[model samples]
Target: MTDWWLWLYVASMAGGTMLFLAWWARPCGVPAIEYQVAVAVPVWSGLWYAVLALGDGRVTDPGGQSVSWARYADWTVSASLLLVALALTATHALPRRHPWLPTTLVGLNVTMIAAGLLADLSAGSRSRYLYFALGTVALLGIFAVIWGPLRSVARRQPDGLHHAYVEAAALLTLLWIGYPLIWLAGPSGAGLLGPTTDTALFVLLSIASKIGWGAFDLARLRGLARRHELALAGRP
Candidate 1:
């Protein structure tokens, strides 16, 4: 399609690559990997929507009636992705450590995708609420399980999957929290989230997401030793 669409597709594919590579390299068993991918696939799938929506360059259609297929596809992908992401996060947080969190996340993610798809056919405010509610659920999950119990474990887990999860969660939360504030002051703040604004937000969110990934990976690489520990332990 257009350069912008191509750009979004390429960028989204890059994100997908990062996600898959990280998942593949995670220090977990086959079952865990499968479980992880179940959720991970959809999250990346949502990013697929990002590519499409960015390519189409409009949230609603020409009539401003409702989310177009292109736009709906974007939402579907996002809903699916977020669903899986949440599932994996919750599974990883299981009190019994049963590996159920990942499976649960996948289940929920699937349900969300289904709901989002069906919502595409709905009329009126119902559609809006579907999207809003999905977002709210994801936000809640992020706060409750990811930031709460998972954070401590994530920070301390050996320099791999665990660490990445923690860092990514923090980065995502921070960016999500900050993005709205930026939009409020930006030109697209007049109750209209334009393509430019969406692009800007997506760029920032992507940067934040990657920063989280990199920081954790770096921490793992460096053994995550603090300054004092490095000094006490002496230079390597």
Candidate 2:
């Protein structure tokens, strides 16, 4: 309801629109399905935040602790898309192995994060700690998937794509690491931080994780395509 909240929402909407447009306007070079999913993730995330901002702001638990259902929803969709993108990238970059790993991990990650959010929304203080502990475990699992299988696949990629994948994954990991900290400082946890601070952090994290990562992915894919074309043409 404050000016900063309004501004943050507007920024989110704008960032989403720009990313979508960039995706739409660009010529397709990468695998269409994967590229589109990567591009769409951030756009959807931006819209979700925008709606959350324009709507009830933050819904509070029975104890008057604030929670953002919209954020949870956004994470559910966007985070899954992120994993899917990683999966697709891994499949493209490396020798095929088990195809089910990425999808399975995506499902688990979403469920875990969703449960944590639900626990955070409970009216009792015990649920708050439960949410924190649950979320920490979920994050560890997510990191394992990224660092283990995902990293192994990326290492097999060509140098450009390998570097891009590593950079994108690192960026995502860094940005996501802040979520529990933000939760701790937010109303759902210790109430050490204000709504404005929460909104600002979420907005920045959303843009970076979604749009920034999408850009890296698209660029990497395009670079891969160019290399393939050059190889076919018998050029460098």
Candidate 3:
């Protein structure tokens, strides 16, 4: 049962990586940094998912909880790239308070996920819930940064780009918020969702979040680049 889901996830990741790379390779005058980050996010995410699939979707922790450490590793790198892409897209609009604000936020977000993973691996039910609470707190902090500083920056982008940024952020946020709930329903929590359903839910979310968002961002960048080229050509 779960094997089918695992294979499907692997296939989707492979297909998505190919498609994303193809779009990424096309010529676009968008900032190289933005382009690189956009491409890297999904590519790396797919790679990690592939690794997870090879390992039969997840590993059982000491407490007999099914844990996807590969997914955590994926989030650590890919999530930071997602932020970097957002930051780069809004570079001109971001506040000048701190040069390393994006990097710091990325680190914090990765730490939050890592903490949650550790909590899921804990032996006792009480520890599981406690660490999960702590992870949730960290998630709230990350959200504050996004909805606060990041939103401010995004709002200053040009109309089309601003809309794109908002869409990307909204989609990513929606998928991410569900993750904690899924955790609660899985082996570590109430065990209501069983491994198969839990694995399926994650696969669907990963497709929507990483692959879908990457494609949208790539299209937005290409459109912006085209408009810029046209504007430059029309200049006196």
Candidate 4:
């Protein structure tokens, strides 16, 4: 059944991507490229989670002739992530540090994308080091956003709601990282404790991130509206 779960994961990811892209493309007015990339991040993230599911286990023959179902899933996921990253970069999302504090996030995640792809390629290597390194890079990328980018942004602008939004994004980023770890631990029958702890952490992180960032988004919007109203009244 890992194979079955793989298919399920793929289906859900694909379906979600299609739906989201369709919705994103529907609006006639041109949206900011970074915003578009931000919206698409979840889809790419979901696809990666599916790959993690596939890579968690193996099905092989007695002669050691490997059937590479996991590799195929990994390739698909890697290709998708690269494409999305490229799209984001092309749309000017990659170098977002301009005019604002230099966002190191794009640079960091680009490294992550590279490391993940390299690890996927070296899956046949005798050393599990490649896997460990890729995971490390990915995790580091997330933490950097939380610690470096979020902290700096919050400090520069102590606006509480703005801080909240950044925190939320950071939390979501962690969840995106955690989902795979949870699956790997659980499906491998490593024990309930490991998987449960990982899942719980991810879920909590996700919840906190959303709540904080959502409030920030709302607060910002409200501030904008109030300012606009004041300007309009002054003009009259």
Q: Provide the TM-score for each candidate, comma-separated.
A: 0.50, 0.85, 0.86, 0.45
Candidate 4, 40-78: lDDT as tens digits: 544544455455565653445333423334433443443
Count clashes in each candidate, considering only residues at least 3 apart in sequence or on different chains.
Answer: 6, 0, 0, 2
lDDT of 4: 0.43
Give me the runs in candidate 1 sitting further than 4 Å from their true place: 1-97, 106-122, 149-166, 176-190, 210-235
lDDT pick, better of 1 and 2: 2
Candidate 4 structure, TM-score to reference? 0.45
lDDT on C-alpha atoms for all candidate structures? 0.46, 0.73, 0.74, 0.43
Better of 2 and 4 by TM-score: 2
What is candidate 2's lDDT per residue for 1-236, written digit by digit as tens?
44466456557556655765666576446767765786678667767766765765467788776677877888888888887787776666565735676777787778767776777678778876876687788788888988887778777877777777776778778888887888778767788878777777766666677777767767677777788889888999
Misplaced by over 4 Å in model 4 are 1-31, 42-103, 113-126, 157-161, 177-180, 183-236
Across 100-201, the per-residue lDDT of candidate 3 in tens digits comes to: 658767877877887888887888878878888888887887777777777777777678777777777777678789889988887678989888899899
The candidate scoring highest on TM-score is 3
The alpha-carbon RMSD values of the candidates against the true structure, listed in the order shown, are 7.1, 2.7, 2.9, 8.0
lDDT of 1 at 209: 44
Which ranges of candidate 2 are over 4 A from the true structure?
Answer: 1-21, 94-97, 234-236
On lDDT, the stronger of 1 and 4 is: 1
Cα deviation of 21 in candidate 3 (Å)?
Answer: 2.2
Residue 180 of candidate 1: its Cα lDDT?
A: 37
| Per-residue lDDT of candidate 1, residues 1-236 (tens digit) | 33454355446546655665665575333234333443354355445545554555335433253333543344344434443453344334333443444344444444544444344344545564565467446545545655665555444544455654665566556655654344333332334665455555655464444334333433333343344356677855
**TM-score rank order:** 3, 2, 1, 4
Clashing pairs in 1: 42-81, 43-81, 46-77, 87-105, 91-101, 91-102
**What is the lDDT, from 0 to 100, of the residue 44 in candidate 4?**
49
Of the two candidates 1 and 2, the one with more favorable TM-score, higher being better, is 2
